[model samples]
Target: MAQISNISKQLQLKCSGERFYELFKNKMDSITQMFPKKLLSYKIVEGNGFAHGSVVHWKYELRGTLEAKQKLHMDDTNKAITLEFIEGDLFKDFEMVAVKGEVSDGGSNGISSVKWSVEFVKANEGVAPPHNYLQFALESTKGIEAYLCNNN
Candidate 1:
């Protein structure tokens, strides 16, 4: 059987949950345009754009230039978005990779908390965890927050 594992991180966001949620949920395609270093370009290959069940083809710069076909699953109630990689370079070491992110109320001050979780199945027992992928998510969150702070 393949080895499955998980990793997660919680971050205090500098922006409101509603702002973050709106951008991520409604304007996902702009991510690559906003951060060209981490993301190159993305195209909605199926479904109604960022809606649940949609499939997106992403060209990104990770270890190098890589492309991935991912399915988007969004939970509006909890402000969570999940990206399941059905095909990509990730499959070289991972049988599967699912990344889930949630934005929520931080407290009365109206700050927000963003949580990122990654679940993966190793193609083989010798494969290492996707720590770099998680790191990319973390840095992206911070970059978005900074951009929002400066722009909004």
Candidate 2:
């Protein structure tokens, strides 16, 4: 059987949960601008960007330059978005990979926090846990928060 593992990280933000959710929902076209050093391109190759049923093609540098195609599922009520990997470099070592990002109210402070999780089925147990990927999400979330607070 394939070995399955999950990892997650959280990032605090000055922006509201709604604003954080809006990044993926509406402002993803500006992804490269927000993280130019990490993300090379993010294009909606199929379906639509606003509602559900969309496929995004991402070309980015993690440990190295990698490309991925993913289908997006957005939950407005929960303020969460999921990206199910359809194809790309991720398949080289994993049998399955799904990434979920959730934005929530940060208690009394009224700040926001984004939680990112990666669930994966490894091709073999020899593969290390996806720490860098989770880190990437955290960094990206921070970038979004900074971009929104400073630019918008």
User: TM-score for each prediction?
Assistant: 0.93, 0.90
Candidate with maximal lDDT: 1
Off by over 4 Å in 2: 1-3, 107-109
Tens digits of per-residue lDDT, candidate 1, 1-152, equal 76669999999998887778788888786666778887888888999887799998999998899999999998999999999999988899998999999998666777698999999998888888998888988988988888777878
Q: Against the correct fold, how does model 2 do in TM-score?
A: 0.90
Instruction: For residues 29-110, write the lDDT of model 2, one tens digit per residue.
Output: 7766778878888778899763467998999899899999989899988989998999999898888998999889777878
**C-alpha lDDT (0 to 100) for residue 6 of candidate 2:** 91
- CA error at residue 109 for candidate 1, angstroms: 6.0
